[model samples]
Target: MSTETPAVRVTDLTVAYGELPVLWDIDMDVPAGKLMAIMGPNGAGKTTLIKAILGLVPPAAGRVEIHGGLYRDQRHLVGYVPQRGSVDWDFPTTVLDVVMMGRYGALGWFKRPGKRERDQALTALDKVGMADFRARQISQLSGGQQQRVFLARALVQDAQVYFMDEPFQGVDARTELAIVDLLKELRTLGRTVIVVHHDLQTVRDYFDWITLLNVRRIAGGPVDEVFTSENLKLAYGGRVEFLQRQAPCDPPPDAPDLGSYPGRIRP
Candidate 1:
């Protein structure tokens, strides 16, 4: 096993809303510089897991560590992209303003972002192919464009690890390709990324590692090792017979569809 410390670690993590248990004794370790995905059926605590790790939701149990430190102490090393639908798109804000928000963790709230921050935001927007829209209203952008902008925001953070919640949802195929390419580039820079993903067809193609969850971790590790027919059966039960047909153990050149969960980030 690689001896390097994991970029993120979760131990006995459990979360809840009042009494409704969401996660259960979850333990995960994401190696540095790896691209990983978290997958599960809808409302299966997939998003909750990310929230708990980010400290957006209080964990009922267990602890999260980033590079061997608590989340509160490692906030500067992390970035997050929430689900697109969760944000109010109609809010009045410029694209550049959105991207600059990423830098706020490093720059205290009392300090305003200056020219250096503006240039960095532009660079990030350019990286995601949205430089020209810097002055545009955030609400005027297409779903894909907005997603790219959020990714640019995350990139500007220069974080070692990033967590994204369902970034591919409703995005155009071209945007999906762009996002995947950007994620690959992040990996090349020795950054670790944990994505809340759903498409089974793209699991092997888009991520080297994966965690399957159904309110609890069914399996997690290298995609080839844990993304199996048996694990799919366990996590999704009878709901995923359409997926277990292949179950993505051995990758194929073509990506097969998995029920209502459609769309793939082609390699």
Candidate 2:
């Protein structure tokens, strides 16, 4: 939104859990107003990258910069929507209570949210079409509804860069479309949105830039240039092959002879 440099920059980034390296030598730059998608197989460190950028997790190597500065210096300009599975939805909290939490970071430590914060939270809920469900308990909402509620929580931050981790996971078609449209609108408004996505089928339609990770940097750039089948094979680690072979229109070649392997016994 602001006439500034890139919203995120990671150079020679490396992260490790104890001695095991998760991300290696990652270098990326995300400009403002771009909808960037990150895709990789499970355990490829997609969420780690997001968490490291948010300063929630420490990276053993490299730097994360936001708006040409360290992320901490620009924390107010960055918002994060973690996976729905990350939180305990059953916690006794109302939807409005969750959305209001976004304002806490801005209000500084020890500061309570006031009427202005409540109004902003409500507006954010409305933005995600969850205003009517404000008073409802988070656990009472559907999975899609909960996802939108989390998104509204992030929206209340009013950040310039939003990092969403699998915002579409388990969501129905309508909810998926609504969230997708909301992300598109964010990009149009000049905010940078980076999403960790799992659905490979809609990559082209949802994102302009794609970053493929596989315990290492596989490829990253415009989707048209980097999202090739070869690159996907490298990113998915043969799992994509299994999915392709199992498609409804194209059954496995040896379906009738499932026990053909030397060690496999036919019943």
| Best of the candidates, TM-score | 1
Clashing pairs in 1: none
* lDDT, model 1, position 4: 80
User: Of the candidates shown, which would achieve the greatest lDDT relative to the real structure?
Assistant: 1
Q: How far does residue 133 in candidate 1 sit from its true spot (Å)?
A: 0.7
Q: Deviation in angstroms for 37 in model 1?
A: 0.7
Off by over 4 Å in 2: 1-4, 239-267
Kindly list the per-residue Cα lDDT of model 1 for residues 28-81, writing each as its tens digit: 999999999998777789999999999999999999999999999999999999
Q: What's each prediction's TM-score?
A: 0.91, 0.87
lDDT score for residue 235 of model 1: 77
lDDT (0 to 1) per candidate: 0.88, 0.85
